[model samples]
Target chain A: MSTAMGNPTAGASPGASPGASLAGDPYAPQQDTVAGPVFTVTGQDWDAVVAGAAEAEDERVVVNMGPQHPSTHGVLRLILELDGETVTEARCGIGYLHTGIEKNMEFRTWTQGTTFCTRMDYLAPFSYEAAYSQAVERLLDIEGDIPQRAQDMRVLLLELNRISSHLVAIATGGMEIGALTVMTIGFRERELVLDLFELITGLRMNHAFIRPGGVAQDMPPGALEQIREFIKLMKKRLPEYAAFCNANPIFKGRLVGVGHLDLAGCLALGTTGPALRSTGYPWDLRRTQPYWGYDTYDFDVVTWDSCDAYGRFRIRLEEMWQSLRIVEQCADRLGNSEGDPVIVADKKIAWPAQLAVGSDGMGNSLDHIRHIMGESMEALIHHFKLVTEGFRVPPGQAYAAVESPRGELACHAVSDGGTKPFRAHFRDPSFVNLQATSILSEGGMVADVIVAIASIDPVMGGVDR
Target chain B: MTDPDARTDDDKLRAGSRGEAAGTAKQEPKVGSTPQGAERDLGVQEEMPENTVVPAGADSLEVIAVREGMFGVQGSGDTSGYGGLRRPVVMPGASPRPYGGWFDEVADRLADGLGADAQAAVEKVVVHRGEMTIHLRREHLVTTAQHLRDDTGLRFEVCSSVSGVHYPEDTGRELHAAYHLLSMTHNRRIRLEVSVPDSDPHIPSVVAVYPTADWHEREAFDFFGIVFDGHPSLTRILMPDDWPGHPQRKDYPLGGIPVEYKGATIPPPDTRRTYG
Candidate 1:
């Protein structure tokens, strides 16, 4: 393995300057290093050869592990300085997936901004949609006036998103560490949550369901039934994670002490979600600073004292139970508020058309279509204006934050009193948490580097956005 | 499920009259700014005309530019006859004393923490829409941030976000960098803003006080071209290093190339029939 790690520098063309660019060809061997010692030991004398190689203390290897490597979890590049098996220094090269979403949002209207941000963190699209919508609502000064049913529905989506996002984190983490069974079960449970999302919002991922004033539409019939069934199924399936990996000797060996970060380190790095909760801080924004009426929901803030990969895993597992508790409460509230308005009462901001599922697909309800087409020329004009121009937000800035499955996801939305936003910036947790790469991976073995990053669990979409 | 039969003919006639009034009113764009003290009436009315509210208090607004067309259109492309729309671009001004809520307390604590240099360090405090912002001079940003974090009364342990905005019309202070700080201990949030001229757009990095600002400051620098003077390795983060212009600036073009299919060329989104 070390011989393969050592040959790239020798393969560089003669006289190429050290650290010169590969000229946009990613597959080309980096010619930055002088040739180093390489060894091959095939016999029982391997011990003697290893001892001799260990004596060459000045031999250091620079390894670039990603931007394409699978274990790095989505285009995360780790530049590592290794001495033997131990990492001496670690640095991160990111932004491989930058799509300029923030800049694109400036041209679209306030309501259209949700569609762009929902794509930022694809695994937790509802969190981005909710945060951005909350910011827009605050700028409009209608935070307190959001309908109770809408708030309850938002809580339901957010909690379900928490379960789904954490499942991906655990599944991918387990897969990276060679535990394929955990990966399969994690995804299996996640699909159930996605099923509920599909039923409620029509699309499984990047639904763009949550809007500035409220959700795109009211809950479809039978959504509550599926949610209740989901809660019941999760109650039984939740224990399997604890049973399978909680006490398994190998899982503990791989995770118990790897990627250890205490409360102080987490705060300094601005880490949140399970990574921070694992330090036993109980600093979840849902509890510490609630939004979307999360304060009204009854649940415990899950935490573990170990401050390591294993503790983060346990926090995610336990937090799913807590999320189920919130989801059930949201389902109950949704059931009671059956006929209430989901969008705001204001005609200027509320979407003009009422939506209903048709034989073809979702579209404006026939009743609404008839009222506009036949009865009211006024309503038709209003619909055309609102649909094409979108709603204008009063000029100002507001920062709205929600505790996402990842961390403190915030949207700092600024408006110039126009239909479009002047500026909209997201404080995505993946972007902030990835800064801890060096602090977490340095001084650890090469294998543990993967464990450390998997613990961070950054989705490159959110990180690069 | 509102009762469709509940709408009386009289009510429908009244609603129809109001809609026609609005349609005629929209054609002749509303002139003048929103009435002063309108901020006090937020969320009080169920229905409001678009662009009637200035989100901040009247005392804290200064009109920077007068927009001449509706939907932000310029030149001769607008044919909706709403091109007569005229509105002022109101930039938030310095707020007066007795700022409401915990904002006043935070401002006082931040000033006391800065001690002798508080007068020069903090340019002004603006409290708008239940959020507090302390405008700090670029030179004193780090010290002000240190005091904000370490001071007992204001232990803003987390630097939540750093964003940059470019106002080309703001002349000497064309570029603004805003930092959102969260005090987990006190359960309060505050923002610190610093502005520099576009000619010399530099603000001292606060990574020393809040290590988490590392990538955020880089992002601000990459998008808005605001230079963070002491950032460890201030390089483009979200955009490629070879990329030419800061894409988020107001002056930057939203670029897209035309596409041709079946011998017909289609213009890009920005060049299409833009509403804004």
Candidate 2:
């Protein structure tokens, strides 16, 4: 730090003379007033502080906060220009986690694209997978042929993913602002949701189950019961969080009126999901566009007029409840839809791998292996052709979007009559929402930048991808 | 920029417009009724949309020689049997109206707004499967995007994405930039595409019209080497500051490593011998 102004007595001790101003009046005795010094100056350090106060410039200082910062949620670097404690300008630097997913997708088969897309927003993998699969389906012109059962299952898993995602958002948002108890509470609830995800999808995260044809397989036995149990647990637990953080003055103070972005700002920045809804606009694609038969499900698009960090947090909390309500409806629908096919009848696009749980965990079913290896040559050829080259989507392009936990996570797919994608780019909400950070954080205290970023909830994996 | 007189592309386009600007001048009444230019299929058998290619003789269109491999890989990497599948590089031709659904409405309205200039500015209008794509000349991208966003009838307020698609097979025009636009007022989405040659990838930046296109344009530049000419601070968005070649472009090598499992080692997918 340039502490030249920190010491006033460097020129005032013994034979030392006071600088120019004191030179004008030798005996005038300088108090060196800078507003009012917060503390009394007596020691050498104190004298140095007062001495250096005269040398201090009102110029701005630039602070580079992490690409490795814990509060940034991922490898996001923020360059902030500060005038004292207040930030004058803020710019976000991303790409620390660019995995080159779009490039990789060009090399993989159409079905393998889901595995890559799911990893973009690791928090809400279902949304990415669904968007990519839907885009391919749109290219195939079989969007209407997807089974009703699969559609319900998609909504079910997506809502579950949203709940788990929002839990992490609130948990991390709370922890960043020093709510340790909430961090524990949030993760604990998230574990339950993840456990349910594991029960149904085989793996908790990066479930490539949602494919071009339909879901990988039907829901396992009694997975709905576990979801029902989670819903019950969350119903009792959500109000407790409300009682804890919502009532805590420190929490409310740090959130409300802090990192405020009104409706116009949200629109200008193209921030959606909770951030936009926080501004009181009900633009949830689930409700507005109603993909995946979301219209059949019963749930309200939650909104809060606060338009600040508190509002973003509040909307996440309520969105989880709405997710729970939707999950409940999906569970009820699962009863009538049990015998229905998950993957569509189009055998060409459908993954025929009879997945089974062996001692080594999930793998291709032994019976399916025997059947394919020993049965008709046509089955073997069909299986080999589908698995290796995958099905070709006629040359075209389509953009598919879904309301992810953060915002509108969209995938734009271009097909050139090839098994692999010609180009697949996901318009990750985290990347878009993060643009508002500079606007929301500037002119606010330096610490509020963390709150602003937390409210924006950018996953650098998604942002960089 | 909207003045039809100053930015005419060719004598043919200029001749087509005539005196359409009668201060609200009499535009070509049927406004580019038939596509006047030739677009060759480059001899690669176009499996889909075969009936759509205009019967004009394939000449003057430079054909790119297809190398052996899936994508552009040189070796055995044909894990998927799609190798040697010659997907003919076909630039979509103009669709005849009733262009179907709300697409016609958007297209007709855009033509009326741009008047005679629409024929020159918009190179082609393609409706594939369900979505509509208006292929604009790269130079007119910014003006067209602004009109799409501000026009009361079109009100495509949201510029959803600005992504680059690289097709090395499409000679001359190898890099195509597509903008996904959302009209919130109309609850519709339309794609705007601009094709530029890989030799000179100069598509005008739409950041002034849709601020959301700012970082997206930078990302397109980073991944596909498409230059958004007027973008503000058009620096790399997703790649490292000093990263060399845009990785997403066709012919960019798939840098892969061999996979080792148990005792056996399998060559990288690109190097694996394929049915092709």
Candidate 3:
């Protein structure tokens, strides 16, 4: 490696003048004859010089990992410089899934932006909506008076989103490493969760149900029953999922010691969620920086100290069970608040009457309209104004962060004192968590890179949005 | 489990006179953004055509009508008459950076430990909104990045995100790339923004300092037409190489051909269309 040092420009200090080295070299003794009495170089000194020479060697080979390859989880390309299979350097390339959602939000109304944001992190749409809505509501300063029932409903929905997101992580992580059976079981459980969401919001994915002021509407009748059934179903399957994947020798071999990231690397790479938690850091936003009534919830923050891929797997599996516990508690709370209004009574922020198509192809009954219009002029005018024009938000900026299944999902919203936000930026967990990939992939087999990425479990929509 | 009754209601609504009348009438405007004071003064009845005459205390309803793009009014109005509009305020110091000299203070603090290479590399520091971004010279980019990570007071440590933006029409700096850096101990974030001329849009790569920047720099190179000098593999991640201009630029016309959705012809942005 030191052969390159023969060039007069070699090992020169960044700021040193070119003339200074030449002046010093010619004046010095030919072989340092005055320093030692013709002493031969020792084996230790030779080894030290050789090691120093090797440090300056530029022998690493560059390899492109993917833009279309599997194990990337998405359209992620990694440029790795390697000495054999060991990576000397790594670079991650992303933005294949960029859809300009932030710029798109600038053109949309405050309420309409929720619909676009929900599609950002596909696996955890509700969590995305919740963070966006919470920011908008905070800017409006009307979130304080939000109905208790609406708050409870949001908690219930977010917890379910957490479980569904983790299921994807577990299933996909297992599948990426050749554990095909875990994928089937994971999807089967996730389908039940999606079914519950479909019953409430009329869509399985991208359910823009949670809005700025409250949910899109009250839970459909028997939605809680479906949720209860889902909880029971997930509870019974949890053990089977663990037994089929977690306890299997093949699964353990592939995951247990692969992609180990120490706590310092995790922090330096800005990793959060399970990636950070698995590294012995107890930094869950739900516990440390509570939002969306998370402070009121009673649950334990699950953590692991192994800081390896298996630790992440264990943490997520345990987190799913904890989410189920929260869901059951939320269902109990919902039963008590059945008759209470789900949205805040403020007409500016909420729809006048919950509009649903009836048997007669009309939004509301004639009698209902008659009672509202003829009997109460204020109600009639309020309904008309709200239906025609939405509420205006005060111009200011507010940020709201939620403990998403991936990590801290935050929305930074700026209103130009208008009905629409001037700018909306999402601090997506996937974007932050994906930073750890290069660090985890280095010094590991190329196959382990797949497991490391799966453990991170980034939703490309969220990462690229 | 499908309901036949639901289908009959949908058919009736489709066939009803109410639907025909509603379709023929002027379509309702998109909600939000009417001056609140003027809207409240117009009162509730003013929305109806029969009650077009101004009501009592309606002097504040000054309607300045727009003629192009989307037609709308922009003036003071009441909440009810104009759908909860609020007056727009010209906030003081609402430029890109609102925090004034604070960015310079932060940048000066960085000058000491970053060494002369980093100091020479950093050209301008601007504070936009609450975010501070230090613009750097392309040649000294790697040195600056290393200082940001290793320096004690400015231990950015992590490169949280990197993205690119295009301003093709803008002179001097047409290709803008931004790097978001975070210090976990400080729990603070700083942005490193660089701009290169469109003619030769190449900046030094930070991949050596933070490996995560490799993908981000390549993406910038791909979408915004910028290039990273030392990037290992810089190629298009989303669009094909034969693709014309950077799509994200504000001036780049969003056009490709019409997309037919549910029998509705949705023309490209550049197409001329007459909406019924």
Candidate 4:
């Protein structure tokens, strides 16, 4: 390939920074008077350049960390300008995993939207599904008609998802800082939650269980008992994290006062979740702007006063405890909502098939098949029409937000009175909070950049979507 | 930028005033008898007979397009026998006064905040589905945002999201950017929308007011090509830097590349037959 075509920096440069190229590109490469050679700072492969340039006597070296770095989290690439060990500037290169999920949703039916959104934030799939479903329900003018049993089930799933997501955040944060035991134990406890999820929704991740009007179906037999047992197990396993790392001097020395951002900084950068809560402000969407019956839940919005990475870590740990409390309450509620319908009563909006596990694995129940195929021709037509064309939403727009483990995951849905959405946009917290990378890591040590980004815990799936 | 196939599909989905006789086959009597182009002028005067959920008053409704089939099909593939489904794709038009609840209070405060330029700044206030949207001209977007952030009565602290929508039919204003602002102090939310023509898609950047708008604005510009003129870094955030065109625009195809199956080439999604 020609140098112009092989070079990724030949086109537009980032911001107002002059592009760095050896040829006629507007961002021409600057001469390195004392170094090996001057290279453009766009490509992900920079180890060879770094090695050759480091041999020089220069103190200022620009390092291109990975779009594939194991420590920088998912596909995030960090370009750090280091004066020896101190980072003077930091820039994030994202969009390595853009799948155009939002654009794809415009062509599919509204019910099919949940399947796509659930895959956006892979760690917190339930949060995205719930937010999208709530938006669709609001646009359909049937928000009040969602059954109580469905609402309770959503609460149950959301709380469990919160626990699992926070576990991964803490686990990955620990592993990035060389604490492998936390990673091992975190996934161990997370597996129990996943087991319960598998029992309930039939998928460990990307469970499209939440639908537009309600959940896909009611819970199976012994699902509640399994949840009760999981909650009991988590209650015992919860304090092990604090006992392991809370008082560990090495962990505190590595994380304390690293990646510090105050309340004003958090608000300015639109950072929410534990990162914002660590600044001693109790700003949670569930408490301030309640949705999906979260207002009725008995839980506290945990906060830490350090305004640093350690505080954010502590906040996540405490928040997991609070999530466990909410899960307990949801289990009690789900137990009382026995035999209640989980989907809406509106036949037009509700999914017709009552799903059952058959010889073919999972398909429409035999009873529903008999009614639609044998008993009533109208039932067959209704099922076919609803399945193919889906329900229509009135022409308008609604914004629904849910507090995901990361932050506020909001879905903005606009319908032009069609079976599919006219425009749908998700305000992914990972995408927004990631803008704080420079602010958090600029004046900090180069090694602390990992701690800073890990504290934010941005999942690149949500960021790129 | 002006792909003919995309425009045809757009017109088929929302058959604006052009009203080409694409799917005018086997007209059912109950659907409509009004001719294609004349429906735009005549239908604007009376409440649509069907679709009761649409608020009454022809003045409030903006008839984006007049449809003539159950499914938005251009040729003879619509065999559902419901070809005569001629309903105008009507958006909830500008809402009237009283606005209700906190919406009126926000409008009054924003007007006070905008001062002398309030009349020129705000084109209209639309309250739909309990959400308030203040449609503003692109020129006054930054000033209005600053006031909304600083004004004590209207303290929308966090600009949670910035999204772009492309309306190819809305002739002078094909590109729209909506800013969803949340006020943590008052615990309320409001949206501000600005529209610009496709010829000159420029809107003043609100990054100075809301620092969080930096990335969101970049994403919007990458997708819709709406330029936030004063942005610090007006580069592509999602798409590749060398990408040919904005992929999220209505004129851009969904772009499903054909897959090669076992000894056969499967058609792309856009080329395949589709149901409603």
Candidate 5:
């Protein structure tokens, strides 16, 4: 890790002074020194010297704000230069969470990349998988109208993930501001969401459940019932959240007007999700660039024009409700399309022809195998070839963008007609969104920096990846 | 075969006149015929119609010739020859448009401003597989992109993505850069592709146009070794600064990492390992 030490003072070098006036000094030799004794005794000279000394004393102080700070949210560091308590300038220092997942994905097969990419943005694992899978599918040119059931399942899982992610954001943001109960409630609720995920995907954190062709498995029985119950429970719990945090006078005092970013600033800096919507852009990808049957769904693009910290908080809260609406619609869609194929028919991109024993200790029915192997030679051949060699993508490039919990998650993939991607770059929202923290924190009190950083809600994994 | 000189004369005639341009060119009529390239087990290329319209004029003729040659070498599969699935539906710019709603109107305005020579240079307007890729003469790429940004129907104010591709075996330019632009108000996307010779992969920088393009172009250059003229800062991003050769090129070897996870040794990239 290399460190960059920026210059801290004027007149620290030979070229420190501005160019001499051309009208007066074109032919004259430039002065290399002050051209006077160390102490000239005129009254104005004495005042000027005193003022310069005082100014030098008050120049600026550099404070490293992270790599392990409480308010940083993750392992982010902001090197801030302050004039007293007000921040003069702030430079964001990141990459503390560098996992080399993008490079690692090059070594893995196309399908295995999902397992690694999904973990980049832990809060929005589905969004990461969706973006990566979409890019690979574009390379293979295999967008075979993913089944309606699969689309609905994706929407359901994505929305649940969104709610779970926002709970963490709000919880951590509150904890940073000394609201202990919010953290407790937020984690408690998030645990329930993770429990739901564990039941459905069989893993808590890196659920490689969402793959290229489709989901890894069909929703486990009673998973929908649990989700429905969770939704009902959340409808009641949301008000408690509001009463505990949103409506609290102290919380409002800390958040409402601090870290204001208007629409123009948000757009200029490329902020999105709650940060952009709070500034009144209302540019949700689901509403604008609809993918995964989002065009068929009905939900409001939530927005708040206040462009303040409180506005961001308000937008996320409302977004949870909108997500709930999406979840309910997805549940209805899934109920109608039960027992359908979760994976697409293209065995080249789908999972291998094998089954795992269920919790009930029984493998999938023997008929499934006979139908795959004995019934369809093409399917069998594709399975054998794909499992052995993996899919070969044509030499091309694809950029797939999805609405992640934080903001737009775009994956730009390039292939050289090979089994592995040549280059896979993730335009993570957290990385870009963190840029606004400097703009928001400038001239604000040092204490407000914590509030501003929290409002941005950057996950270092997403930032550094 | 017909007289070659007569075909050139007919091509000149087609270039001179707009109404007779599509018909007068005496080249083989298999305009969009699929190429018969070496076959791989993976069915990647999609087949195209033999007599698809090829745009008239010198630049368009060159692009069509290149596209045809690509297809000739690589046999077009069952789908459209323009890569990927056959004719993916394009989401047209809708009225009362959702997100960046003003893109279509802006793109049109830009095209009109570029006038006929530049517009004629555009070879194919493809909206296959849901991606909008505009094929244009390599010479007119920067100019067309400028027009797209400045024109009315296509105010692609944001160059959201810029990437490179390598095709070592191809006869024409083996390296290409695909630029994705977004009209924030219009909510439309247009992809601009520029191909340069692999021997000296170079293209004009769009950094002066879109600031966000700086890092993306650098990354492309870093991985693919594609050079951008007049870029502010061109340097390696994800790889070590002193690394040799472009890692993303087709001929470059994929390096491996040796690791044992749960008592299983992960083999390197060169070693054969079943994906499943």
Candidate 6:
């Protein structure tokens, strides 16, 4: 940390407005081109822009692309200073969909925190759910108590979510660059993945089925067969995605040399996942620091040396194939472990809901009710106690990080020996990785900004959450 | 425990491989500024011993523990369903030496790297569960973090995350900033924590050392109002620019409006009855 080095705003000045990078003035001198003029309204950066303009003078305008454009990839706003068509500088403005998820977690119980986390990175909700659940499980000091079947299911679901999420990245990244054909094909594959999710967890999205003690329940009958079918279907579709984008000149040209962020920039900006892997560093948390039995899974950590949008796009394409291999292994494990409890052995932390879908809907199993009401008073009391006042977590904090589709999606759970979370701060990879857009997009053509951001694949729900 | 042991064996083998790879990586043409800890600390403390082995374990000391109430309220909320639950949450005292696997190795490395100021810089070393946390004085955060990064034996190059936790009950220093650092080279992880009193909530930012901390510091400022002394731009990130208060502070309300449905009203959970 540098000290206040004479410049009032350089180091630590309390009043330094962070948004000033994109804080252009609404009433600055304007130069008209397409998308309006570069308004020097931010007032301070004007002189610097003006001074730099003398060296490479043209009509250098500041273009505010989006807090709400279709192609900006979720409500990300880019403030780009264009010298003719080439962008001289860029800055990002985020937090359009701030729901205060971190603050809201304090009001909910430990088991309920999974529901909130899963919603952050919506594309790969299961991984976020796993990270939060794993943290709570660790906080209870019962990471070991979770069953082998439960851990296997977590890996299976997470890898499935990764394929679906990467499909979205390819689909959306293609759509951003006018490759609409690939988008249709990508989402078609995503539909198959989401179908498997619905079959396994009973929800297509935001599945809180991954519980603190273990998963909410065991896999539905023949759910493994559905995954096996999806894997076979996906293995066929994988080459189609590669063939569509890998050969198209328009797609390759927009990505190959454009929006280039070197390996050093990736680290400085905290870029990981595919974007980091594209820089030729196979630093996947699953391989470098394994969690949730990922170490046991067999898969090659895919990497690329190009370090551009093309490299990033290729990595996601290759990663899907790798995810399928992992899923295939999970299906094999599930076959041998039939009727194993998905929930932990301890009755305390595990949610004891019977979860039977009847005429009314999913609710307490009628058999569980009969057993409690007609058979045992102790069973009823235990059910009532666990549900009403959730289990207590020993006072402490633990940070859990998992490799999601975006990057290292992590959560810091603090418990003050209470049933509810004291405070849970999610270190969302989207929020951190979104910072790299400025470093990558600047000094490149204005059109490539979209190419860069789409490759990063940030979900504003995660960023703003 | 069984899983980690097997992973540990795997990690040692991987560490040996990574070490050989790094030796070759150093010879590659300079791409840009290297973020590796050892490379950055090149000449800072060259005189120190290459590596120092932590001696025998110091006998653990006993400190008086207190169960003080937060805001002077003993069991503030109503206690009904959870009344029987008793968990005396104690802030752990300083851990004794020979602190289990890899922890003592890290502490010894930090001591050798920092030299004479090691004792003063490191406020307390707590090894809880299987993880170790090095608590540092607020002013020494950056220097200590640099040492944690640069030391050859303890190269926690990647800072996994930085989170702010407000413990209203912990008097004097109630707000704590925790950093989770990862040593990909050695396949190990450790936590670093720096606490600042609510009266003066300031800790020097480590953005220069770990550029990834840039947005995270802004986020901590937005939610918890922790003033990072050397942060480049300390402004609101997640919150609206004009948002009034730090929302994550324990004193702040959960602020959810009651939901009105068809002929029914359910108050937000915070306003509902709760056990103390």
TM-score of each: 0.87, 0.84, 0.65, 0.88, 0.73, 0.83
Could you tell me the C-alpha RMSD of candidate 2 in Å? Answer: 9.5
Task: For candidate 6, list the clashing residue pairs, or say none.
Answer: A24-A42, A25-A41, A25-A42, A38-A62, B37-B150
lDDT of 3 by residue, A375-394 (tens): 98988878765543445565
Per DockQ, the best of the predicted structures is 4
lDDT leader: 4
Which segments of candidate 2 are over 4 A away from where they belong? Answer: A1-56, B1-92, B273-276
Q: Rank the candidates by TM-score, best first.
A: 4, 1, 2, 6, 5, 3
Write down the C-alpha DockQ for each prediction.
0.44, 0.29, 0.10, 0.49, 0.14, 0.22
Question: How do all the candidates rank in terms of DockQ, highest first?
Answer: 4, 1, 2, 6, 5, 3
What digit string (tens of lDDT, one per residue) describes model 5 on residues B66-100? 22221212334424343421111011111121113
**lDDT for position B16 in model 5:** 29
Q: What is the interface RMSD of candidate 4, in Å?
A: 1.8
* Cα displacement (Å) at residue A401, model 6: 1.4
Question: B205-226, model 6: which lDDT tens digit per residue?
Answer: 9999888898888988888889
- Model 4 DockQ reads 0.49
Among all windows of 10 consecutive residues in model 4 chain B, the one with the lowest summed lDDT is: B22-31
For candidate 5 chain A, which ten residues in a row score worst on lDDT?
A34-43
| 1 or 3, greater by lDDT | 1
Kindly give the stretch of ten consecutive residues in candidate 6 chain A with the minimal lDDT sum. A1-10
**Candidate 1 lDDT by residue in tens digits, A47-105:** 43344334444446666677878899998888887787899888888889999888888
Better of 2 and 4 by lDDT: 4
- Per residue, candidate 1 scores C-alpha lDDT tens digits across B150-221 of 999999998989999887755577898999999889999988989899999999999998899999999999
For candidate 6, the docking band is: incorrect
First chain TM-score for all predictions: 0.90, 0.88, 0.82, 0.90, 0.84, 0.88
User: What is model 6's interface RMSD?
Assistant: 6.2
Indicate the worst ten consecutive residues by lDDT in candidate 5 chain B: B85-94
lDDT of 2: 0.76
Candidate with better lDDT, 4 vs 6: 4
> Which candidate wins on TM-score?
4
Q: What would the per-residue lDDT of candidate 4 be over residues A1-465, giving only the tens digit for each residue?
A: 001111223223221222223345546353332322445544553443444444445556566787878898899988887777799889999999899999988888899999999999899999999999999998887889999999989988998999999999999999999999999999999999899889888889989999998999898999988888888888899899999899999999999999989999988989999988999889899899988788999999999999899999898899888988888898888888898999999999998876898898866699999998899999999998898788888877778998999998899998877788888999999999999999999988999999999999999999999
